[model samples]
Target: MLSNFDIPLLLGLAVLATLGMVTMYSAGFDHGSRFVDHGRNMLLAALILFTVAQLPPQRLVQLAVPLYTVGVVLLVATALFGITKKGSTRWLNVGIVIQPSEILKIAMPLMLAWWFQKREGQLRPLDFGVAGALLLIPVGLVMKQPDLGTSLLILSGGLYVIFFAGLSWRIILPVVTLGAAGIGLIVIMGDRLCEPDVDWRVLHDYQKHRVCTLLDPTKDPLGKGFHIIQGMIAIGSGGLSGKGFMQGTQTHLEFIPERTTDFIFAAYSEEFGLAGVLTLIATFTFVLMRGLMIAAEAPSVFSRLLAGSLTLSFFTYAMVNMGMVSGILPVVGIPLPFISYGGTAMVTLGLALGMLMSIARSRRIMQT
Candidate 1:
């Protein structure tokens, strides 16, 4: 079991997990037992990672269909009868409250990789279409729940699998171009489009507000824009070296909201400064490169696709969380992988890492 573990990857994870605990200690010291809870969550995630790494890639493939099916069913159930909090119905009471969308973060990649692996030799455009449909069903369901962050993660994970499974640049380039154009248009018409009376039919009113707030947070400094405004301030306040550990005035003074959760990046940035942020990014990059290497060496199609997608999912999580905190993107409530304090997100991340480790172990066993 010890030999099955990937040393370099484990080392990278250990570094990040350690940083998370240290940051949480400072960020949540005032919040009773929050630091303690964060440590407990990390241990749980470690346990999950260890348990999952023992499974073989083939065993994981066997789990894909049933997991995806159950995920979609729970999503549907959440939409129909889930608990509503702060105007979003994203959790269901299945013995205990759970957010079903979290399952798709891992299951989406698993199911897509399994689909492509089944049609390995004689692939067709129709196979991609079927895969897209499978991907969209749960994404659409989660979007209806209005949990944009989780849906985006799920969407990106599935798309990464599709892209790795021979998706042509011909189809990808045009979509990328269109998205870029849309962003440019939004910037050009920011003021007009952000007017209260103008209906952005696709987005909920609050979601629309979040986009407008991202465009210019000062527009409502103490209202809907508070999160972005404060986040940027904390990050900017952390200069070359930082204010020193446990000395973040912005974080301790309560300027940075959600210091232990969604906005932890801002709190982390405030205390650690630009230097610390770079170190954190370098560690994440190391893990990412390591994961991609594992994927490149994977012995099977299912393993390769799964490993690649899950690896990129970490990229998405870090980039999105950091981007939102730094004022470059709309605040979508994504946590910074091991750094942010959240049980569900932590567990989800552990499962992803475990799958990657499992694939890596498989390759080494084959070589032996």
Candidate 2:
């Protein structure tokens, strides 16, 4: 099976996995035991990637519904008895503290794709409405857990499935217009959007703080604004060539919070400079383009939607992390793909890559 796979795509994924391990090592070196844990996670991710790549795309499609159903149940369980940390209930313990929402990041696309496949060539506006509801179920739950970043990522992945399923622009255009107007209204209203004496019914306090911080980081410079301000400083201070690897003052001195996780990009930029940043971005672009090509050639609608959504989700992860680090967006705890140090996220990404490989290989088989 390995011999029959798409060699270029497999090789690209291998290269990325290698890069992830190296970056994790550097990022976790000071945090004693973290480096070892990251190494273990990388190895596990590699194994899962290989295993999933060997599976047929049709088999994956068959498993979609069950996978999604189990994932949604786990998310509901998390909401009920989850471990609360940092004012968010996003993790559940079934011997291990696991984030169930990560599972939905992949599962949502799988289920939507499967649904689309069932209704292929007969899609309607009402079908799309149902799909949107399917997506919102998990998204709403995660948001109530107050894991804004993860919720947005899951929502983005689900939206990708809708887009790839030939969802009409007639329906999409009005939604986009409303979204734009809503954002405009928020900006116009500013702090009043979440006044304490007001209704206080819409957003959680932390979520509201994130938006307020995005609007004006200086407003709470020493408090909630610190992450954004420090992240931007680290990014901008890199200039053209970086301060050199392991020589990042902000990172070394511990000024950058979550240095090995959400804000890893700031540390990376401060160390490797503009050239390194471009190289990383180029690799990500290559992966996404290749994944999309695979989706285009997939043998089934399910494979196509899953592959496309996974690709876009990968892109969103990179973009959101970089945007947050550069101070252009709110400080959401989103890891830079393959570059940040975390076991669960690495495994999730590996699974996504594996599904892409499966889609590509299935297409190759069909061509023969």
Off by over 4 Å in 1: none
Residue-level lDDT of model 2, residues 44-77, one tens digit each, is 8778888898899888888888988999899899
How well does model 1 score by local distance difference test? 0.94
Q: What is the lDDT of residue 245 in candidate 1?
A: 96
Model 1 lDDT tens row, 1-368: 77967899999999999999999999998988989999999999999999999999999999999999999999999999999999999999999999999999999999999999999999999999999999999999998989888889999999999999999999999999999999999999999999989999998898899999999999999998999999988999999989999999999999888999999999989999999999999999999999999999999999999999999999899999999999999999899989999999999998999999999998999988
Candidates in order, TM-scores: namely 0.99, 0.94
Best by lDDT: 1
CA lDDT scores, all candidates in order: 0.94, 0.84
Best by TM-score: 1
What does candidate 1 score on TM?
Answer: 0.99
